[model samples]
Target: MRIFVPGDAAAIALGADDVAQAIQNAAARRGLPVEIVRNGSRGMVWLEPLVEAETPAGRIAYGPVEPAAVSGLFEAGFFEGGAHPLRIGRPEDHPFLKRQTRLAFARCGITDPLSLDDYRAHGGLKGLERALAIGPAATVEEVVNSGLRGRGGAGFPTGIKWRTVAETKAQQKYIVCNADEGDSGTFADRMMMEGDPFCLIEGMAIAGIATGATKGYIYIRSEYPHAVAAMREAVRRARKAGFLGERLPGSTHSFDMEVRVGAGAYVCGEETALLDSLEGKRGQVRAKPPLPAHVGLFGKPTVINNVISLASVPFILAEGGAAYRDFGMGRSRGTMPIQLAGNIKHGGLFETAFGITLGELVDDIGGGTASGRPVKAVQVGGPLGAYFPRALFGTPFDYEAFAAADGLIGHGGIVVFDDTVNMLEQARFAFEFCAFESCGKCTPCRIGSKRGAETIDKIRGGIDPGANLALVQELCETMKFGSLCALGGFTPYPVLSAIRHFPEDFGTAAHLAAAE
Candidate 1:
C-alpha cells in the first residue's frame, strides 16, 4: 500500500508531521505493508495534512487529518480506498483543484520534491534536455515566442529580458532569481521552492544557456527556512546527477547555481535592490536607466527574473512557446498562479489562464468569505496592490485589465476582505507597513510614509476630517509619483483604492462608527 503526506512547510505547521507519524504507527500496528511518501502540498491549504492513499481507481484523499484520526481512518479501510468521513475523493475533482490550468505547478504536490527519479517520472528536465538539443539561440526564440511576462509584479516580457542579456557582451553574465517574496498576501515563491526545487534549478539552467550565463543565484527571503533547506538539498542532488554543475549531459555548455538568503526586507523584492542585497550590501532600490540587463551584480550584464517567471521557462521550452501563448487573453498570455488568501473560504493556490474575472476567483473558486459575511473588498497583488470593491469584480485578471481599473495583478495574490472590515483602517495599515518596511533610501518614501500614517491617524481622530481626506490624497499622489521604489510608489494603491471605493469607512470617528 502507498500513502502520501505533504512535507511542505504549510502542511507541517498544521500538524502534518504528527499525522504522518500516526499513519506509520497505525500501519505497523495493523501489520500491513505500507510505503509512506512525503510529497509537497497540492496548494489546497485549508485542506492540508491531506493524506492520499493510492488505489487502482486513483489517489484517494483525506484532508485536515489529525494524529488522533489515524486509527479511525485505517478502520474505515482508507488503504483500500474505503469511504470515510474525511474522504474528499480524488482531490483533482474538488472544485478548488479542478478549476486550475496548472502549467508551472504541474509537478507540484504530485511528486516527492527531493526525489530526482520522481521528477523525471513526472516529465522533469525535459525542457533543459530540449534546450541542450536545440542550442541557445533557438531556445531563446522559443521563450520569446511564448507570451510569458514577468510574474514578479512588473509583468515585463521574460523573453525580451533574456534577449537583452543574451545580446549584451560580458565576460561574466549572471542569472539572478528573485525569491524574496515579501508581499503580504504572497506565498507562491516559498511554496514553489519547497514543493519543486528542481523545477527552479532546471529553469535557471535553461536561463544560463539562453543568456550565456554560467552562474546563477536564487535570492530567497530569510523567512522561508524550509525553502532554503529544500533548495540546498535539490541543488546537491542535481549536481550529483549531472543535471547541474560544470557541464551538461549531452552538450558542451556548463552552468552552476547557489541559493542566497535575503535579510527579509520588502524592498529586496525589487530586482535592483535584490542585486545590492546579493552583493553583501544593504538592500536599497537602484535607479533604472542602466537596467539590470546592461549593468548589474558587480557591474556585469545580468538576467534577473522572479521565481515564477524562471520556473515557467522549462515548460515553454518543452511544450513550445506557442502552446503557452495560446492560454490567456489579450496581452496577458499564459497561465497565472493566482494565490487566494485572507477571508476566503477555500483559500489556496489557483493556477489558471489569465482573463478569469476577479469575481470568479473570489466567489466561485474561493467560495466567498470564510466568515460568511459579504465580501467588501478584494486586494489584488500584494499589500501595495489596489483594493477592488464589489462593483469592479468583473475586472479580468490581466496586467492591462487591472491597470485599466487603477489596480495591478502584481504577483497574482488576491486578499479578500469581508464587510466587517474598515477600509480606512486598511489604508492606514498600508502606510504603516510602508513606513516600517521602507529601505529609507529616498526622501519621498522615508518622510512621506511617516507623514501619510500621521495624516490617516488625524482623520481617524476627528481632526478636520474634510481637509485630512484631501491631504491624504495629496500625500498618496506624491508617494505614487515621487517615491524611489515600489515600497512607496505602490503604497498609494491600497490607500487611494480604499478612499475611492469605500468612502464611508474614512473620515471622522463618528462617521466610522455610523458605518459600523
Candidate 2:
C-alpha cells in the first residue's frame, strides 16, 4: 500500500510531519505493510496536510488531517479508498483544481521531488529529450513560436530574451533563474522548486542549449530553507544522473548550475539586483540600455528568467510550441500559475488560461471571503498590484487587459480583502513596504516612499486631509516616473487605485477639494 503526505513548508506548518508519524504508527500497530512518500503540496493550501492513499481507483485524498485522526482513518480503511469524513474525493476533481490548465505545475504534486526515478516516470525529461533531439536552433525557434513570455512581472517575451543572448557575442554567457520570490502572497517559484525540481533543472539545461550559456545559477531567497535544501539536493542528483555536469550524454554541449542564496533582500528579486547579489555585491538595481541580456553577471551576456518562465520551456519543447501557445488568449500566451492568498476561502495555487475574469477567480474559484463576509477588493499581482473593486470584476486575466486597466499581473499573486479591510491602510502599506524594501539606489524610491507614507498618515489623521491626499498622489507620480526599478515604479499602482476606487476609505475627495 502506498500512502502520501506533503513535505512542503505549507504542509509542514499544518502539522503534516505529525500526521505522517501518526500514520506510520497506526500502520505499524495494525501490522499493515505500507510505503509512505512525502510529496509536495497539491497547492490546495487550505486543505493542507492533504493525505493521499493510492488504490485501484486512483489517488484518494483526505485533507486538513490531524494526528488524532490517523487511527480513525486507518480503521475506516482509507488506505483501501474506503469512505471517511475527511475524504476530499479526488483532488483533481475539486472545483478549484479542475479549472486550471497546469502546464508548469503538471508534476508538482504528483511526484517525489528528490526522486529522479519518480520524475522520469511521470514524463519529466521528455521536453529536454525533445530539445536535445531537435538541437539548439530548432529549440530556440520552438520557444519563439510558442509565444511564451516571462512569468516574472515584466511579461517580456521569453523567446526574444533568449534570442538576444543567443545572438550576443560573448566568451562567457549565463542562465540565471530568479527564484527570489519576495512578493507577498506569491509562492509559485518556491512550490515549483520544492515540488518538481528536475523540471526546473531540465528547463535551465534547455535554456543553456538555446542561449549558448554554459553556466546557470538559481538565485533563491534564504527565507525558503526547504526550497533551498531541495534545490541543492536536486542539483546533486541531477549531476549524478548525467542531466548536468561537464556535458550531457550524446551531445557536445555542456552546462552546469549552482544554487545561490540571497539574504532575504526583497530588492534581490529584481533581475539586475539579483545579478549583483549573485556576484557577492550589495544588491541594487542597475540602469537600463545595457540590459542584463548584454551586460549582466560579471559583465557577461546573461539570460535571466523567473523560475516559472524557465520551467515552461520544457513543456514548449516537448509538446510543440503551438500546443502550449494554444492555452492562453490573445497576447498573454500559455498558462499562469496564479497564487491565491489572504482572506479567501480556498486559497492555493491555480494555474489557468489567461481569459478568466477577476470575478470568476475571486468569487468562483476562491469561494469568496473565508469569513463569509462580502469581498471588498482584490489585490492582483502582489503588494504592488492595483486594487480591483467589484465594478472592475469583469476585467480579464490577460496581460494586455490588465495593462489597459493600469494593472500588472505581476507573478500572478492575488490577495483578497474582505469588506472590513481599509483600502487607505492598504494604500499606505504599499508605500511603507516600498520604503522598507527599497535598495536606496535612487532618490525617488528612497525618499518618495517615506513621503508617500507620511502624507497618507496626515490624511488618515484628518489634518488637512484633502491637501495631504493631493500631496501623496503627487509623490506617487514622482516615484512612478523617477524610480530605477519596478519597486518604486509599481508602489503607486496600489496607492492610487485605492484612492480612486475606494474614495469613502479616504474620507472625501482630495482632488475635488483641490479643484474647489
Candidate 3:
C-alpha cells in the first residue's frame, strides 16, 4: 500500500509530519506493508495533513488527523478503506476543492513532484512537447488564445508578455521567475515550488522555448527552506532525465535553469529590484519604460514572471488555450489560485475561477472568523492590499473587480480579521511596513512613508484629529502617485482602506479618556 501526505510548510505546521509518522506506526502495528510518500497538498488546504491510502478504487483520503488516532485508524482496517471520522468520502466531493478552478495548480497535490515520469503521465511536459512539436510562434499564439494572465499581483496577460519578449531582439534573453514572495498571507509560490516543482520548471522551459530565451532562473527567497531544497532536488532529477540542461527532449532548443536565493528583502519581489538582487547589488526599484521585457537581467531582454504564471503554461499548452479561456469570466480568463490565511477559521490555499464572491469565500468556505465573532474586515492580496468590509463581500474575485473595490488580487492572498480587531492599528502598521521596506530609490516613498506613520500617530493622539486625518490622506496620495514602485504605490491601499471602512478604530486613546 502507498500513502501520500502533503509536505508543504503549511501542512508541516499543521503537523503533517506527525500524521505521516502515525500512518507508519499504524501500519507497523497492523502488520500491513505500507510505503508512505510526502507529496504536496491537493491545495484543498482545509483538508490538510490530508492523508491518502492508495487502493484499487482510488486514493482513499483522510485528513486533519491527530497522532492519538493512529491505533484506532489501524484497528478499523484503514488500510482496507474502513469508515473513518476524518474521511470526507471522496476528496473531490468537498465543496472547497470541488468549486476551485485549478490551472497553475492542476498537477499540484496529484503527482509526485520529483518524479519526471509521474509528471509526464499526468499531462506534464505536454506544453513543452507540443511547443517543440510546433514552432515558437504557434506556442505564443496558443498562450494568447488561452487568455492566461500573471497570477501575480498585476494580472498581466501571459500571452502578450511572451509575445513582447519574443519580439525583442537580444543576444542574451533570460526567463526570470520572481519567487520572492514577501507577502504575509501569500504562499502559493512556496507551495507550488515545493509541491509541484516540475510544473514551474516546465513552465519556465516553455517560456524559454516561446521567447527564445536559452536560460532561466527562479529567484526564491531564503525563508522557504523546504522549497529551496525541493527545487534543487527537482532540478537534479530533471537534468538527469534530460528535461533540463543543453538539448531538451532532443529538441534544437537549448535552455538552462538555476535557483538563486535572496536574503530577507521585500523590495526584491519587484522585477527591477529582483534584477538588482540577482546582480548581487542592494535590492532597489528601477524606472520603467525600458521595461524588463525590453531591457532586463544584466541589460538583456528578460521575461520576469511569477511562479503561478510560469506554472500555468503547461496546462495551457496541453489543454489548449480555448479550453482555459472557457473557465474565466470576462477578461479575467482561466482559474486563479486564491490563498486564505490569518484570522479565518479555515486558513489555506483555495484555487478557483475568477468569479466567486468574497462573501462566499469568507462566509461559506472560510466558515467565518476563527474567534467566532463577526468578521470586521478582510484584507485581500497582501498587507498592501485594501480592506473590504462585509458590505463589499459580494464583489467578485476578479482583478478588475478587486481594482474597482480599491483593492488588489495580489497573489490572491486573503487574510481575514474579526470584529475584535482594530483597523486603525492595522492601517498604521501598513504605513510603518511601507516605511521600513521602501527601496529608497524615490523620495516620496522613502520620506513620505515615514511621515505617513507619524501623521497617523498624531491622529491617534487626538491632536488636531481632523486636520491630521486630512494630512495622512494627502501624504498617502503623494506616496501613491509619486513613489517609484509597488512597495510605495500600494502602501496607500491599506491605509486608505482602513480609514474608509473603519473610521472608529483610528480614534485616539485620548478620545476614549475624554468620553469616559
User: Against the unseen true structure, what C-alpha lDDT does each candidate score?
Assistant: 0.92, 0.92, 0.86
Q: Give the root-mean-square deviation of each candidate in angstroms.
A: 2.2, 1.3, 2.7
Candidates ranked, most accurate by TM-score first:
2, 1, 3
| Structural similarity to truth (TM-score) of each candidate | 0.98, 0.98, 0.96
lDDT over C-alpha atoms for residue 421 of model 1:
95
Expressed as tens digits, the lDDT of each residue in 97-212 for candidate 2 is: 88789899998988988999999898889988888888888888999999998998999999999999999999999999999998888999999999999999999999999988
List candidate 1 stretches off by more than 4 Å: 508-516
Better of 1 and 3 by TM-score: 1
Question: What's the true lDDT of residue 251 in model 3?
Answer: 88
**How well is each residue in 170-283 modelled by candidate 1, as lDDT tens digits?**
899999999999887888888889899999999999999999999999999999999999999999999999988888898888998989998778889989999999999999
Q: After superposition, how far is residue 211 of candidate 2 from its true place, in Å?
A: 1.1
lDDT of 1 at 324: 97
Q: Over 4 Å off in model 2, which ranges?
A: 511-516
- By TM-score, how accurate is candidate 1? 0.98
Candidate 3, residue 474: Cα displacement in angstroms equals 0.3
Clashes of 1: 0
The global Cα lDDT (0 to 1) of model 2 is 0.92
